[model samples]
Target: MADEIKPAAQQQVQIPVDVSNRETVYANFVQAHLNADEVYLELGQFSQVVTPTGPDPIVLSHRVIMNFVTAKRLADLLRRAVSQHEQMFGVVEVDPNRRLRVQQPPV
Candidate 1:
Protein backbone atom coordinates (compact mmCIF):
# COMPACT_ATOMS: atom_id res chain seq x y z
CA MET A 1 0.00 0.00 0.00
CA ALA A 2 2.84 2.41 0.77
CA ASP A 3 4.44 1.98 -2.66
CA GLU A 4 1.18 2.24 -4.67
CA ILE A 5 0.72 5.42 -6.77
CA LYS A 6 -2.65 7.24 -6.74
CA PRO A 7 -4.15 8.86 -9.86
CA ALA A 8 -5.09 12.50 -9.57
CA ALA A 9 -8.61 13.58 -10.53
CA GLN A 10 -8.76 15.29 -13.91
CA GLN A 11 -10.82 18.46 -14.11
CA GLN A 12 -11.82 20.55 -17.12
CA VAL A 13 -11.64 24.30 -16.73
CA GLN A 14 -14.22 26.35 -18.57
CA ILE A 15 -13.35 29.85 -19.74
CA PRO A 16 -16.30 32.12 -20.43
CA VAL A 17 -16.23 34.71 -23.21
CA ASP A 18 -18.27 37.86 -22.72
CA VAL A 19 -19.54 39.28 -26.00
CA SER A 20 -22.32 41.51 -24.67
CA ASN A 21 -20.23 44.65 -25.00
CA ARG A 22 -18.27 43.53 -28.05
CA GLU A 23 -18.22 45.83 -31.08
CA THR A 24 -17.38 44.61 -34.57
CA VAL A 25 -15.40 46.57 -37.15
CA TYR A 26 -14.59 45.61 -40.72
CA ALA A 27 -10.98 45.92 -41.80
CA ASN A 28 -9.61 45.71 -45.36
CA PHE A 29 -6.12 46.81 -44.33
CA VAL A 30 -3.75 45.57 -41.69
CA GLN A 31 -0.35 46.97 -40.82
CA ALA A 32 1.92 45.05 -38.50
CA HIS A 33 4.72 46.44 -36.41
CA LEU A 34 7.05 44.88 -33.86
CA ASN A 35 9.57 45.91 -31.30
CA ALA A 36 12.00 44.02 -29.13
CA ASP A 37 9.32 42.18 -27.14
CA GLU A 38 5.90 42.84 -28.58
CA VAL A 39 3.88 42.81 -31.82
CA TYR A 40 1.44 45.53 -32.81
CA LEU A 41 -1.42 45.03 -35.27
CA GLU A 42 -3.19 48.02 -36.72
CA LEU A 43 -6.49 47.17 -38.37
CA GLY A 44 -7.99 49.67 -40.76
CA GLN A 45 -10.17 50.24 -43.80
CA PHE A 46 -9.05 51.68 -47.08
CA SER A 47 -11.04 54.61 -48.43
CA GLN A 48 -10.55 56.58 -51.60
CA VAL A 49 -10.20 60.32 -51.37
CA VAL A 50 -12.58 62.35 -53.54
CA THR A 51 -9.77 63.34 -55.86
CA PRO A 52 -8.50 60.72 -58.28
CA THR A 53 -4.91 62.00 -58.14
CA GLY A 54 -4.29 61.30 -54.46
CA PRO A 55 -3.43 57.99 -52.86
CA ASP A 56 -6.21 56.27 -50.91
CA PRO A 57 -6.14 56.57 -47.14
CA ILE A 58 -6.38 53.82 -44.58
CA VAL A 59 -8.55 54.73 -41.63
CA LEU A 60 -7.24 52.93 -38.58
CA SER A 61 -10.02 51.36 -36.51
CA HIS A 62 -8.34 49.22 -33.88
CA ARG A 63 -4.93 48.23 -32.63
CA VAL A 64 -3.98 44.99 -30.91
CA ILE A 65 -0.72 44.62 -29.01
CA MET A 66 0.56 41.28 -27.80
CA ASN A 67 3.73 39.37 -27.06
CA PHE A 68 5.67 37.43 -29.69
CA VAL A 69 4.41 34.06 -28.45
CA THR A 70 0.79 35.14 -28.72
CA ALA A 71 1.43 36.62 -32.18
CA LYS A 72 2.96 33.36 -33.37
CA ARG A 73 0.05 31.36 -31.96
CA LEU A 74 -2.40 33.71 -33.67
CA ALA A 75 -0.54 33.32 -36.97
CA ASP A 76 -0.79 29.52 -36.72
CA LEU A 77 -4.49 29.68 -35.84
CA LEU A 78 -5.18 31.97 -38.80
CA ARG A 79 -3.27 29.66 -41.14
CA ARG A 80 -5.32 26.66 -40.02
CA ALA A 81 -8.58 28.55 -40.40
CA VAL A 82 -7.67 29.74 -43.90
CA SER A 83 -6.62 26.23 -44.88
CA GLN A 84 -9.93 24.82 -43.70
CA HIS A 85 -11.84 27.51 -45.55
CA GLU A 86 -9.89 26.88 -48.75
CA GLN A 87 -10.58 23.16 -48.47
CA MET A 88 -14.29 23.73 -48.06
CA PHE A 89 -14.61 26.33 -50.78
CA GLY A 90 -11.66 27.20 -53.01
CA VAL A 91 -8.38 29.09 -53.00
CA VAL A 92 -8.91 32.68 -51.88
CA GLU A 93 -7.30 35.11 -54.28
CA VAL A 94 -5.72 38.02 -52.50
CA ASP A 95 -5.00 40.01 -55.62
CA PRO A 96 -7.99 42.04 -56.72
CA ASN A 97 -6.75 42.24 -60.32
CA ARG A 98 -6.40 38.49 -60.56
CA ARG A 99 -9.86 37.97 -59.11
CA LEU A 100 -11.33 40.40 -61.63
CA ARG A 101 -9.55 38.68 -64.46
CA VAL A 102 -10.82 35.27 -63.40
CA GLN A 103 -14.37 36.59 -63.26
CA GLN A 104 -14.17 38.12 -66.74
CA PRO A 105 -15.55 36.27 -69.76
CA PRO A 106 -13.36 35.38 -72.72
CA VAL A 107 -13.60 37.95 -75.49
Candidate 2:
Protein backbone atom coordinates (compact mmCIF):
# COMPACT_ATOMS: atom_id res chain seq x y z
CA MET A 1 0.00 0.00 0.00
CA ALA A 2 1.23 3.55 -0.86
CA ASP A 3 1.21 6.37 1.73
CA GLU A 4 -0.68 9.54 0.87
CA ILE A 5 1.24 12.84 0.90
CA LYS A 6 -0.21 16.09 2.28
CA PRO A 7 0.30 19.70 1.26
CA ALA A 8 2.40 22.19 3.25
CA ALA A 9 -0.64 23.66 5.03
CA GLN A 10 -2.09 20.23 5.76
CA GLN A 11 1.29 18.95 6.99
CA GLN A 12 1.43 21.69 9.65
CA VAL A 13 0.78 20.50 13.20
CA GLN A 14 -1.13 22.47 15.80
CA ILE A 15 0.68 23.33 19.02
CA PRO A 16 -1.30 23.43 22.24
CA VAL A 17 -0.91 26.54 24.38
CA ASP A 18 -1.04 26.56 28.15
CA VAL A 19 -2.18 29.88 29.69
CA SER A 20 -2.92 28.61 33.17
CA ASN A 21 -0.69 31.02 35.08
CA ARG A 22 -0.46 33.97 32.69
CA GLU A 23 -0.61 37.46 34.18
CA THR A 24 -2.38 40.04 32.04
CA VAL A 25 -1.08 43.62 32.11
CA TYR A 26 -2.47 46.63 30.27
CA ALA A 27 0.24 48.82 28.69
CA ASN A 28 -0.57 52.05 26.90
CA PHE A 29 3.07 52.77 26.15
CA VAL A 30 6.07 50.69 25.16
CA GLN A 31 9.78 51.45 24.95
CA ALA A 32 12.30 49.42 23.00
CA HIS A 33 15.97 48.94 23.86
CA LEU A 34 18.35 46.85 21.81
CA ASN A 35 21.88 45.61 22.41
CA ALA A 36 24.19 43.50 20.22
CA ASP A 37 21.95 40.41 20.16
CA GLU A 38 18.69 40.85 22.05
CA VAL A 39 15.86 43.40 22.18
CA TYR A 40 14.18 44.59 25.34
CA LEU A 41 10.55 45.70 25.22
CA GLU A 42 9.34 47.60 28.26
CA LEU A 43 5.57 47.81 28.52
CA GLY A 44 4.05 50.51 30.67
CA GLN A 45 1.15 52.83 31.32
CA PHE A 46 1.57 56.48 30.34
CA SER A 47 0.12 59.04 32.68
CA GLN A 48 -0.91 61.98 30.48
CA VAL A 49 -0.38 65.17 32.40
CA VAL A 50 0.75 68.66 31.45
CA THR A 51 3.21 70.17 33.86
CA PRO A 52 5.62 73.10 33.93
CA THR A 53 8.42 70.68 34.71
CA GLY A 54 8.57 68.25 31.79
CA PRO A 55 6.82 65.45 29.90
CA ASP A 56 4.61 62.86 31.60
CA PRO A 57 6.14 59.68 33.02
CA ILE A 58 5.42 56.10 32.10
CA VAL A 59 5.07 53.55 34.89
CA LEU A 60 6.55 50.33 33.53
CA SER A 61 4.78 47.07 34.32
CA HIS A 62 6.28 44.29 32.24
CA ARG A 63 9.58 43.74 30.49
CA VAL A 64 9.94 41.21 27.69
CA ILE A 65 13.31 40.33 26.21
CA MET A 66 13.57 38.45 22.94
CA ASN A 67 16.01 37.82 20.11
CA PHE A 68 15.97 39.81 16.83
CA VAL A 69 14.23 37.03 14.89
CA THR A 70 11.47 36.70 17.49
CA ALA A 71 11.07 40.50 17.57
CA LYS A 72 10.55 40.61 13.81
CA ARG A 73 7.94 37.85 14.00
CA LEU A 74 6.15 39.68 16.82
CA ALA A 75 6.14 42.90 14.76
CA ASP A 76 4.61 41.11 11.77
CA LEU A 77 1.92 39.53 13.95
CA LEU A 78 1.06 42.91 15.49
CA ARG A 79 0.84 44.55 12.05
CA ARG A 80 -1.53 41.83 10.81
CA ALA A 81 -3.72 42.11 13.91
CA VAL A 82 -3.96 45.92 13.56
CA SER A 83 -4.81 45.59 9.88
CA GLN A 84 -7.61 43.12 10.61
CA HIS A 85 -9.00 45.37 13.35
CA GLU A 86 -8.96 48.42 11.07
CA GLN A 87 -10.74 46.48 8.32
CA MET A 88 -13.49 45.40 10.71
CA PHE A 89 -13.97 48.86 12.27
CA GLY A 90 -12.14 51.95 10.94
CA VAL A 91 -8.60 53.35 10.81
CA VAL A 92 -7.09 53.72 14.25
CA GLU A 93 -5.73 57.18 15.14
CA VAL A 94 -2.28 57.16 16.69
CA ASP A 95 -2.16 60.85 17.47
CA PRO A 96 -3.36 61.53 21.01
CA ASN A 97 -4.52 65.11 20.27
CA ARG A 98 -6.52 64.00 17.24
CA ARG A 99 -8.21 61.25 19.21
CA LEU A 100 -9.07 63.67 22.02
CA ARG A 101 -10.53 66.15 19.54
CA VAL A 102 -12.73 63.46 17.97
CA GLN A 103 -14.04 62.45 21.37
CA GLN A 104 -14.93 66.00 22.43
CA PRO A 105 -18.67 66.89 22.67
CA PRO A 106 -20.12 69.81 20.72
CA VAL A 107 -20.90 72.91 22.77
Global local distance difference test of model 2: 0.91
Per-residue lDDT of 3-107 in model 1, one digit per residue for the tens? Answer: 878898898999999999999999989999999999999999987455666777679989999999999999999999999999999898998788777465679
RMSD over all Cα atoms, model 2: 5.3
Q: What does each candidate score in C-alpha RMSD?
A: 3.5, 5.3
Q: Please give the distance, in angstroms, between residue 26's alpha carbon in candidate 2 and its true position after superposition.
A: 0.5
Summing lDDT over every window of 10 consecutive residues in candidate 1, give the lowest-scoring window: 48-57
> Model 2: residues >4 Å from true position, as ranges?
1-16, 49-56, 103-107
State how far residue 18 of model 1 sits from its true place (Å).
2.0
lDDT by candidate, in order shown: 0.90, 0.91
Q: Give the number of the best model, judged by TM-score.
A: 1
Model 2, 52-77: lDDT tens per residue?
99768779989999999999999999
